[model samples]
Target: MAHCALEVADVFRSLGPGWHQSVNLSLGQLKVVSAIEQCRSAALGGHVLRCEGCAAIEVAYNSCRNRHCPKCQAAAARRWLEARQADLLPVEYYHVVFTLPAAISEIAYYNKAVIYGLLFDMAAETLRTIAADPKHLGAQIGATLVLHTWGSALTHHPHVHGIVPGGGLSPDRSRWVACRPGFFLPVRVLSRLFRRRFLEELEAVYHRGQLQFFGEHTELIDPGVFAKWLAPMRACEWVVYAKRPFAGPEAVLAYLSRYTHRVAISNQRLISLDERGVTFRWKDYRVDGRTRNKTMTLAANEFVRRFLLHVLPAGFHRIRHYGVLANPSRRENLSKIRALLHVALEAVDPDGDVSSCAAQPSFVCRHCGSPMIIIDMLQRSRPIRAPPPEQCHA
Candidate 1:
C-alpha cells in the first residue's frame, strides 16, 4: 500500500536544488532542506529483507530523522510517546494554548533563539502562577509544553501547546487538589498575566540588546522607538485558552502524538503539484463558515520560502516540562502524587506476557500477509548529484 499519495520529500527532490540556486538561506535552513531531500532514500542506506512466507525481497531505506522533515516525525513522536506513557497520572489533563501576537512575530523571525526561549518561560510561568493563586486552583501543577512556530499554510505564528494535569499537590505537598470538572484555570486571568509578564521580560531583553532588528524593524534598535512599539501590544488581549479535560490518560496520549512533533506541513495535506505550483489544504481559523478548509497554491519558490521560515535555532529545545513535571523531580513527584490520590502504579508485565503494545514490526510481507525478516544490511553511500548552486532560496 502507498504510505502517502504525495510526500514532502518529493517536493524537495523536485524543487529544492532549483530553490537553492536562486536565493540566500541560513545554515540551519540549508541543512533542513538537504535533510528532507535525502530522507527515506538510498543515500541514507537500507536493509534488505526476505518474506518468510513467499520469499519476496524488499528494501527499506533509513530516514534522515531530522526534526523538520515531515516523513521523520511519526517515528520520533512514537518513540517520545512511549517514554511518556509511564509519566501519565490518573488525574484529568488539560490542553492550553499560548499564542504570540503578530507584532512580536516579525521580531521573532530574526531573534528566534532569544524570543522563543522567552516565550516558553513566560508561558510556563503564567500557568504555574495563576494555578497557584488561592482564587484559582491554589496548587502547584505540572505541565508539558511543546513549541510550534508555524500555523497552517506555513505562516510564522509562534505558539505553545501545554498539556497540564488538571490538579496539583497542595502547598504542603500532602494532599491531592483537583480542579472542578471540565475546568482548569481562568482564561482571562491567564491572558492578563501572560501579557504583562511577557512584555516586562521583552523590555528587559531589548535593553540588554539581546534582540536584533533588521529590514523594516531597524528603527526598533532605538530604546525609545522600541518602547513605543510595544505600548499597544500591552493592552491588546493575548490569546490564552484551555480546552476541556481529556477523556483519560489514553486520550491524552493520543493528543500528544499529534501535536508534539508536528512540522510546518505534513505529506497528507498535499493535494497536487503542477505548473501552477504546490496546492495544499489549510484551515482559516479567522473564518467562521464552511469555507474555512480551503486549498492554497503558491509558486514553487514561495512554497519553499514559507517552509524554510520555520527552521528553529539549532540545539534550542521545542519540547519542555515544567513545575512538578520538570525532569529532575518527575519520578519522585509522580510517586508522591500517586500516594496522595490512592492510585496504584500501572501493572507490570512479566516475562513471556503479551506486551502492552506490539514491538515495532521490523518488516511486513506484502505478498502473503506475513512478517519479513532482515536478511542483509546495506552500507550507506554519499549520493552523487550536480553541484548545488552557490546561492540558495531564502
Candidate 2:
C-alpha cells in the first residue's frame, strides 16, 4: 500500500469544480467528485482529540464513506475483510478473470447498467456451468465475483474477477469434490462459454430495448446492424484467464483486502500534479518485463474525465456472490461444507460486541504514545482553521 506524496483528493481540491463543469458528468460521477472534495475536510465537519498523556490536541475530519472515494476505501476494505474472515473455508482458492472484448466494452461505455449486470451473471454462470459438467470438475461451485470496469490507465475495460474455491460439493451433496492439484477449470472452455452466453444475453437485452446506443454506436440500434457488430466478437477469443491458486485461505484474505475495495485508481499511483498535467504510474500490459509499470501524464481535466468514466450507475453492485456463496444459501452451504471438511464452526458472539470487531489502531499521541481521546465536538460552522502552527503534527 505505498502511497505517493500527493493524494487524489489534493487534485480534486485544487481543480474539481472546474473539471466538473467542463464535462457533462453523470449524477453518480458528480457525487463521487463532491465526496472526494469534501472528504476529511472542514466542509464535512470533524472532531478534536486530546492526547491522554501529552495534553497535545489534534483535529480529525469525517470521511465521506462513498465507495468510490479513494481516500475512504482503505478502512472500508479492512472492515469488509474482517466480516468476511469468518467465511473463509479450509480449502484452496482460485482466481479467475473474465474480460469483455474491446468491441463490447465500447458499447458498455454507453450501456453500463445492462452490460455490467450481464458480465456478473454470465461470468458466474460460466464458472458454475463448466464446473458442473461431468467432463470438468462435476461439482457445484460458488464464487465471489467482483466487477472492475477500468484498465491500468483508467480505460473502460469491464471484467469480473472470480474467487472460487478450488473445489465444490458433489452433485449428490454427499462428498467434497476437489479440483486437480494446481488447476481449476480450463480457461479455453470458460472463454468460449462466457463469450457465447454473454452475447446471447446481450442480444436478448437489445431485442427488449433495454440497451441504449449513442454517438458512434447509434447505428447499432438496428437489429441487422447490431448483429453485424456482434458477429466478429462471436468468433474472436474472449479473455478469460486463471491465476495460480492462492497459497491458502489467508492469502485469499490478503488478496481480497486489496482488490475488494479498490476504486478506479488509488492515491498511491499519483506521482505529481503540475501545470503541464498530472503524472501517475500505470502498468502497460502490452509491454514486456522491466518496463511495464510506466508513468502516464494526462491533462488535469482529462485525468478527471478518465477517472469518471468508471463511475457506476446508482445502486449498482460491483461486488457479488453467486451459487453457494450467495446470500440466501450461504449460511447453510458453509455449514454443510465445514461439516464435510471437518472444520469447526467459528464461535459467534451472540451479544455482538462492537469493540471486538474494531481492528484499527487507536489514534495515539505521536510524542508520548498514549491513546488520544475525543475532547470536543467540532461543528461544520467552525471553519477548519489551521491548528496552532507550533503545535500541529502534520
| Index of the highest-lDDT prediction | 1
Can you tell me which runs of candidate 1 are displaced by over 4 Å? Answer: 16-18, 289-291, 347-360, 383-394
Worst 10 residues of 2 by lDDT: 385-394
Off by over 4 Å in 2: 1-4, 16-19, 289-291, 350-369, 381-394
**lDDT of each residue in 1-394, candidate 2, tens digit only:** 2334888777776684455554566656666777777778788888898988989988888888888889888888877777777778888899999999998999898889999999999999999999999999999999999999999999889999889998999999888999999999999999999999999999999999999888899999999999999899888998899999999888999999889989999888998999988899999888654548799999887888898888888899989999889988887898889999999966655332234666545577777888888888767643322223333221
What are the lDDT figures for the candidates, one per model?
Answer: 0.87, 0.85
What lDDT tens digits, residue by residue, belong to model 1 across residues 121-226? 9999999998899899889999999999998989999999999999999999999889999889999999999999999999999888799899999999988898
Per-candidate clashes, comma-separated: 2, 0
Candidate with best TM-score: 1
For model 1 the TM-score comes to: 0.93
By summed lDDT, which 10 consecutive residues of candidate 1 come out lowest? 347-356
